[model samples]
Target: MLSLNSSAMYTGASALSALAAALLGTGTFWPIGLLYEAANVLVAIIAAAAIRERGAAGH
Candidate 1:
């Protein structure tokens, strides 16, 4: 279940990044959104990786 949520978050981050890039290319103020999403994505990935590592270590 946690993994699922992480996956969703990662997906959302990817979408947000894409949208922000598009907006920026169009000469808009999308940096804030892009930074926010990128951070979320990075956090989600790190969390997921940590969870997997712990599970693998039988902790």
Candidate 2:
């Protein structure tokens, strides 16, 4: 099911963002923390856009 797969991907992306936030809040790994946070945000935005497009298409 494409919808199911898309939902999983969106959920995974959100999890990544949450994990990055947790790591950043912990105040450790300064350099890598910034990188992960940026990556998470990017992934989340892309995932959200994909989900939106799928929804618009009636998927």
Candidate 3:
């Protein structure tokens, strides 16, 4: 049997959750995956903007 470290296990669990979500939701798996990825990117952009704004404010 193979072993998974903590981070790898967490990542594996996340992937399984995404697969289940895609399978049970409406539409195909591909679209759901795309939407999931898009949401991640949107969040990343928002977080980056907030971090930059905070740094500029000097606090």
Candidate number achieving the greatest lDDT relative to the actual structure? 1
Tell me model 2's lDDT, rounded to 2 decimals. Answer: 0.83
C-alpha RMSD (angstroms) for model 2: 6.6
Please report, in order, the local distance difference test score of every candidate based on alpha carbons.
Answer: 0.84, 0.83, 0.77
lDDT of 3 by residue, 1-59 (tens): 24557777689669868776867676566766776787689879989999999999996
Off by over 4 Å in 2: 1-28
| Model 2: per-residue Cα lDDT over 1-59, one tens digit each | 99999999899878977776777777887856677778779989999999999999995
Please say which candidate is ahead in lDDT: 1 or 2.
Answer: 1
Which model scores highest in TM-score? 3
Error in Å for residue 19 of model 2: 20
Give TM-scores for every candidate, taking all chains together and pairing residue i with residue i.
0.50, 0.50, 0.54
TM match of model 2 to true structure? 0.50
Better of 2 and 3 by lDDT: 2
